[model samples]
Target: MFSTLNWFGWALLSALFAALTAIFAKLGVAQINSDLATLIRTAIVFVLLCLYVAGTRQWSNPLALSGHSWLFLGLSGLATGASWLCYFRALQLGNAAQVAPIDKFSLVLVVIFAVLFLGERPSLREWCGIALIAGGVMVLAFKEQG
Candidate 1:
């Protein structure tokens, strides 16, 4: 599926999914605690991912990955777990409308990291997007005057 679109399209789709998640989670978390909510969501995702891999028979290709691949995959899992932990804590502390915008600010971090570590150069358009994202996060952090 990801093979079909360009990077811009993929980024847009990811942003849309993130926004949908924030909206749904904000509604759902109003009734349930974040830990329980995280557990339930993680369980559902685990089942779905397991079934998808099983259906695709990707489990049979274990030797295709190198040791370095496994190492990176493990690190990726750790990063994901940390992100989930912090995200739930943020949701518990504030409205998702506010939290989600701050979370979206990670793109600016990504831009910095990519330039430093990956030696990837962002185009002018991407810089514009990052600037707008930073501005949005600043606006989200401030209280609305009456």
Candidate 2:
């Protein structure tokens, strides 16, 4: 399903989701502890994922996955859970506006990891975009100062 779209569309959608999530989460965390808020959000996502799995009946295909695939999936899920915990904790202690920009820096880290682990070298155009992204992030991070 994901293969049809060009990678740019995927990146755009992911960025849009991240932007909106920061805004909504900030509003949500204002009235609750980050942990509780994270729990609520996770519960909702879990329900949605479960529904999707049931609807697709993919839940019955567990045997199709190789042991290595299952191990990677489990690790990826654990990492995502850990990330949500840290994100909520940060939002609880700081403004979402601030946290979001810092969190966005993960893109830079991801580029580095891609080079190291995936052996994917970015083209010049991609590097320019990354530079622009970094500049934009810096601007957001300092928005309150000016």
Compute the lDDT of residue 16 as modeled in candidate 2. Answer: 92
TM-score of each: 0.82, 0.81
Residue 127, candidate 2: C-alpha displacement in angstroms: 2.0
Tens digit of per-residue lDDT, candidate 2, span 1-146: 77597889898889899889888888888888888998999999999999999998768778888999999899989988898989888877887887898888888879988999999999999989888888888888776645
**What value of lDDT does candidate 2 attain over all alpha carbons?**
0.87
Question: Any residue pairs clashing in model 1, and if so which?
Answer: none
Report the C-alpha displacement of residue 120, candidate 2, in angstroms.
0.6
> How many pairs collide in each candidate, listed in order?
0, 0
Model 2, runs deviating above 4 Å: 1-7, 143-146
TM-score for candidate 1, please give it. 0.82
Best by lDDT: 2
- Candidate 1 off by > 4 Å: 1-9
- Candidate 2: deviation at residue 40, Å? 1.7
* lDDT tens per residue, model 1, 1-146: 87799989998998898888888777767778887877777888899999999998778676778999999898988887778767876887788878987887888998999999999999999999989989989998777889
